[model samples]
Target: EGKKSLNFIEQIIEEDLQKDYKKEDLKFRFPPEPNGYLHIGHASSICLNFGLGERYDAPVNLRFDDTNPTKEEQEYVDAIKRDVEWLGFKWAKECYASDYFQQLYDWAVEMIKNGDAYVDSQTSEEIAEQKGTPTKPGIESPYRNRSVEENLDLFEKMKNGDTPERGHVLRAKIDMTAANMLMRDPVMYRCLHKNHHRTGDNWKIYPMYDWAHGQSDFIEQVSHSFCTLEFLPHRELYNWFIEKVSKPGDFEPKQREFARRNLSHTIVSKRKLLQLVEKGYVDSWDDPRMPTISGLRRRGYTPESIRKFADSIGVGKRENLIDVSHLEFCAREDLNKIAPRVMGVLDPVKLVITNYPEGEEEWLDAENNPEDESAGSRKVPFSRELYIEREDFKESANRKFFRLTLGKEVRLKNAYIIKGEDVVKDDEGKITEIHCTYDPKSKSGSGTEESLRKVKGTLHWVSVKHAIEAEIRLYDRLFTEETPDGVKDKEYLDFVNPESLKIVTGYLEPSLKDSKEQDKVQFQRIGYFCVDRDSTSAKPVFNRTVTLRDSWAK
Candidate 1:
């Protein structure tokens, strides 16, 4: 039997199946801390964890490791769920670490009673000082060997709001002399009177992430815990907490780490992303220039393209900076097949057909999408007075220039061929209007012999009388440097591209007047654009998603 090749994680699952694990027992989870909006880096993780569940026919839980009350919020929780669903994956259950507060507390008490944990009354700075580097053994805390009864009393006091915030902390009674600095009696819980987003102010002490993460997975009976490479060091602490709480015959959730996908020229750290938002470096988390999931969606990125990009990158053990172009390429590839083509002149120049009849209009056939036959076609209105791209015309040019140069003929897209004769300029010698003569017999698809006549250039135009006015936002890369965050000496904001966004009014075909928000279309010779949510019936706004090609590479 032919079988698909498996990733390392898949291979691990298959190996587990051969040993004792049942296919029905295969449960996966994607646990994201609800501190900030999910970014493109998180999209990769979402796809991976959800993809594993689909491949194994298992249930995947959407768990929020909302341990810190100071940062976690319902807004972030809602955004995370929306992002996960937007990526086209459904979780089996939406769980939160705070939901298991009582159970986790009871387990912490059990560990204390078992003489495997103790209360340490030390400042965070003091504790950090005692936690020696990897090259040296950490010094044991002064209160490490307190009797179990006293430790329990202190922990209860800490939880009952009797202790000041940061007065004391509960530490796992692991080896302080252990070579792994994280294993050297790490803190399990801390005193924080802050109100939790979910649990409220019912308790004072909260379990640390290392303490809550694995236990929550165990409580849900998750079989496979997938995390990024940064959590690899914490995996030891994750298992240590799980080992103390697990009962015999219970399924212990296994932790496996994969490298995080780093998109070039952008920062994905939630803290840094929050900084970007708070500092007003970007418009918002959903700004098109941002690498956030909402930003991508607003910028015309489809779920299919993102999922395809994740698949293309695949699962790797070592982190690598992926070129942002690959993502753009995927978006372009997906959009090219479905996006309807429309004529929109960003920099409009009036073009008059000198010989054409005045006060006359005609509708010409134009395909909605040339790549898809079933997309069908639509009628685009044309007339003697039309608007073409300002750069599409020149008074005089070499033979190599195929556009609307003097005495040079060019085909009007879906219309008749025309020859430029004269141009009207302003006082400043700026070209204002161009005059051209159209070949009446050379109408496109007319089936007449003149229709077969080939021109060196073709131009897209919109009838002046019927054209719709639109605000076009041209977006470029957010950062000018290839790796803005990689530079150690400078701030990431220093590399922000000042001209990342350019706004201009454009003339579009009348068919686009009714375009609703998020409607994607190709602006003929321009680029792929998405109808902005700010659009209204009177005026429409469009965001340039990506250019016709790799404009940056050029």
Candidate 2:
């Protein structure tokens, strides 16, 4: 009851329905340009579109707003499809703006012949200078009044590849002194000799994003065209283009804006992300520490958790910056329910039980996942010799310390109670091993009275003989400062976290030998981890997604 109600977008849709808008008229889309992999921000949009579709029993289309040939790629398109499916959403149809290129070109020709558009031959700089700032009125291009027949012939030649890239641009005829600068004769088409990812070199002219976006939505009969707040000013131009091109009875898609999701501690801009990858600030686009969806997936984020997060944040009209911990909390919450707990000794310290029978070994049953009964249990080998986490042992522990220490008795999880007796060291005096004696009567799960004995310390361990060597990667925040964008004077690279990624060869339970990539597991008393894409059958590598407690860090 204490939580906030549903967001404004939901309210708007509900109100629309109440006012007699048919459910059949509702169609939404998540249109992304196939220029790069989808990021967490895109995840929010996907959930919004698909979630609304499910709620209203409407269909949502997955459209590629790919208009720039220089940046778009087929690889990105494939990856986007994979990501959307992975997030548990199915699109009604997969459409590309390029599919409507011919229709858009015909419409542009119509506009030129009707005196609503013209071709401008001015340089990009000159056009920008004339299209003045938000507060200033813009100056019209010199070619604004070009004769209709001449403009059409030139446009046809431009499409036929007779013109060089940027040699001429088709601009919509609009008021130059409009309050919104975007409406000041916005560029509709441009000549590009480069090959399109989908269209190839079939045509030399392509429509700009503004001209192509609204028309695509109108053609698909979208009822509500949603966009981030940055496009608020461009809404006027988007609607104007629709009114000029749409036939009678065609849906005039309403444009609605919502604030974009901004996290307090990360950078989401593709350009900055690209810089980070190119500069070696991260391993690749899918680096566990990066914000891309693939990166989050590689970092052990579950689709269910991310969807829950998007649902929780909901849709809002005003801007807000969410704390990164909220995302971590959601991920941790989801992993805690499904991840199988296993023993791993990152910093191994040898423990020898002097009182146990020589060369004795036992198979102790450990719960795989306490949260899910269907997960059952697994056998963990316990023997006279075991390896515990180095952090679990202490030569000199404080009064509040609840882990293993000299002269202290602690419970070996799924095993017997053991008391630290002594330590063995090399010539340099650094302790190499700990000597302890197991209490014969304190065998775990045994019916004996001593089996019920309680101890403050409980430690996880691996059988020294059954342990598998593994390379574990520990990741931290990518940037040292919480607000990477806040640093204006110094480059964001200066704040790159030097210790963001740490690699260590550790001893893991042999059960993990065949774990597949992206498989998630929890290291007892450590953290949740996922098998990295870089892992191979010969060497299983894992990335520490996040620790059990937020307080622990290297």
Candidate 3:
């Protein structure tokens, strides 16, 4: 059978193919502005473009639209490349709009010679005022009709570093009264004396994004230029530049816009994210709470999970806000199949096996991943003294409570069944320890009737003597409000969740002592976690990836 039904973009490509568009000519490009790190929203674009390339066996170039030297940096460029590769994509070529600086300058000069563009000496505010609103027609700039020769001289002067910054901007001499505001004399080039990350001080003026993007696509021979819906209005201008620059038989890149993937309870705006980093709202760009690719990776989110999420959401034309829980659900689904099952106690309380030998210890067989039988099993050390979640026990709980309580029987996962008998408290009346007795015949997986006995609750425990102490970071949504950015007259930062991150010491199974950074595992009955980069041999750290169940809604 043929492949699955196509998305709108695929249908467009299919129609083009019927019109004699060669499958081999179906080249695409993913262009990212290197002003900030790549976020989850960008991942969808990456997957779409790269996945198309894979499906058609075509080439997809990774292009950095680093035209605005004021904000673009080499660090951001490197991060973008790293993110793409980490997502299991290989670009046909790594290209940058800055690479076509000379070609873009030459094209601008041609436009000036053709009397289709001119230099305007208007402040940004004046330019904005001239543009007018959607319902109203814009007034023409006073300098719109400058002679081609004069505009040429001024442009050359601007390029030669003689023009003051923002004193004169090269504008395409399009209709001022055009229905689409972007078509009304858009700025094509501007003078900025800043040092470019790639070009350094070689050029004093830079082409605006509208001028650079389409031309770069045309120069690279990209067949399709995919962008978010915000750029839908800019498509006309994108084509206009291609028309002005294209030579005979030169391929014109097609611009298609898709709705941006917006996640609830978080802001994906680079400016706001930067504010969070600069103002110390987060530890860094890789803070687990961040929606950045690096942050997700650091938080134990596997590339498989993110790719699955991108696929599950698919491509759409209408804007929609996806619940963050959906993303967590995907992570849980992927982690369940592969992540090893281990025991961890985030809030530890000592459990003393009163009837067991005090100095004796035994190793019990434990399944690594029940969903993946091939993952087999491992030996977990069990001893008289063990640590369980402090909340798992109480002085007395109702019959509805399945966990440990006085006179209640609970099975220790991979070990024997134990009954809580007594509790020891400190001077503050807080239960410090619980005394219990175990039925040795009830050891898990043993071929005995006692082993088949069922209990209302199964508790995961780590032997206190062999437990590895680890620093655990529990993360939640960065914002309390689901639509923080949608609120009128309110700062998105005002909705920042103060309890987004919580740090606690945890006791882990001994097998995790050798865990390396990025290794993912599921803490039985707790959550999925990833070994953190900050982990060391002496002191390991883990970031809670997601809970065992969806608790946010509850």
Candidate 4:
């Protein structure tokens, strides 16, 4: 095998391996707060951690940082697990921060006894005010000098629910004058008198994220705790808590930072996504227009496509907006090799063969996927009357137009060559049906000389008698702006594209009647689509994944 170039995160690991870290000591983790569905941004991190595990033959843990009960839920936890597993990686252990709450509480008590932590009686706002600015020293809390006995008693009261929810909080006794604001006596625990998803109502006080994260990593003996660059400042505090909890010569985890890759036209913030849901901008978390993993899945994006996207973008020291087309390109590249080609006319206009027998129909052999011969072929029904895209025809078109028009011959895919003769219109002058005549000798794939006749266009169509109707959902970008949240004075929701979703009934070839939920297909001349989970025997529904090519390209 060739020596592969390493990403910066891998280089950090290599540097560690050269130092005191052994290959056996390599352990990584993907810790996500279970508050919402995992988005495309999280995919990069998941791939990074799990990719590292695969590269080093180490174990990766799936740990839910479910420290906040007010926002976190078991549904989100289960969704995180499902999304991770769907991305084709397995965790060595399924862990949660709440699992070590008792251990963290014990450590806090020990820190109080050693004067390393003190219970503050001020409200959270007061504590924040005292944190001060980076250039100025923070004011010390009035309860900074509380006795160990009194601190322990108050901490117990906070834990026992005897204190009001905002009454007392435990703060690490760090330097108040530290330049790093996070180091200025950061709150380690706060009172939250709410029922937890996992540990229902047994405790009142919960540990803060900074207090729980590094300690959980230490407890799990995670060798490298790689988080987003936002946590670079938290590294000092992460280590401080780890040092206070670990004894001399004990395992110490290293914290590293990586930049987040944001997708164009999409806001990766969970809070904003929740607003989109609550504001009725989207139907649900798994709405096909959403950027969430389940949403992508429902939109016919393959697991391999997502992983390829993550790896192609890779990790970096700086963040940038990745054009959503690149993601669509990845989906097209994968779906092309797998998704079967089917004919589904979204805007149907009738076409009649004037000479062909009206009562007769035939099943024609159609290649399932021209890109994959092993995918075999399927039978598509054809008859005298067919439905083609309403935009595929014109009474008179210039030289550049390749589709059907008066006196211009075109091939019916997998069937026969036909030429437009006349049109039947309604009282309102709308072209109701196009009348055409077929050359009987030009059946596709037949060994006749006429069958090989070159035509400027090949139109996909479904037999009028055999066509199945399906509810087709055409989706566009959810937001109009490339960076909806980046603009000043405008909420992301203000940029929501009102035309993101358009629903219509489509006429599909009979070969698609047997398609099950999640089955993907390239609807010839239209776009890629998938059978939605909501599809039933009587009412089939399909979601448009992406267009055949980048439509937004300039």
Report the Cα RMSD per candidate. 1.1, 1.7, 1.3, 1.0
TM-score, cand. 1: 0.98
Q: Where does candidate 4 stray beyond 4 Å?
A: 1-4
Give a tens-digit lDDT track for model 2, residues 358-431. 78888988889989999999888888889998888888799898988888889998889999989999999878
- What tens-digit string does per-residue lDDT give for candidate 3 at 1-554? 79678899999899999996888789999999999899999999999999999989999999999999999999999999999999999999999999999999999899999988999999989999989889999999999999988999999999999989979999999999999999999999899999999999999999988999989999988888889999999999999889998877876889999989999999787777889999999999889899999999999888999999998899999989999999999999999999999999999999999999989999999999989989999999999999999989987888888999999899999999999999999999999899999998998989799999989999999999999999999998899999888998998889999999999999999999999999999999999999999999899999999999998877
lDDT winner: 4
Q: Superposing every Cα of model 2 onto the true structure, what RMSD results? A: 1.7
Candidate 2 ranges with C-alpha deviation above 4 Å: 1-4, 552-554
Better of 2 and 4 by lDDT: 4
- Give, for candidate 1, the lowest lDDT window spanning 10 residues: 1-10
Query: Which lDDT tens digits does candidate 1 get at residues 108-182?
Result: 999999999999998999999999888988999999999999999999999999999979999999998987788
Error of 3 at 43 (Å): 0.7
lDDT of each residue in 1-554, candidate 4, tens digit only: 69668889999989989988989999999999999999999999999999999999999999999899999999999999999999999999999999999999999999999999999999888888888898989999999999999999999999999999989999999999998999999999999999999999988999999999999999999999999999999999999999999999998998999999999988898888888899889999999999999999999999999999999999999988999999999999999999999998889999999999979988999999989889999898899999999899999999999999999999999999999999999999999999999999999999799999999999999998999999999999999999999999998888999899999999988778888999999998778999999998788999999999899999
CA deviation > 4 Å runs, candidate 1 = 1-4
Task: Estimate candidate 1's alpha-carbon lDDT, on a 0 to 1 scale.
Answer: 0.92
TM for every model, in the order presented, reads: 0.98, 0.97, 0.98, 0.99
Q: What C-alpha lDDT, on a 0 to 100 scale, does residue 338 get in candidate 3?
A: 92
Query: What are the lDDT scores of the predictions, listed in order?
Result: 0.92, 0.89, 0.93, 0.94
Error of 4 at 509 (Å): 0.8
Predicted structure 2: clash tally: 0
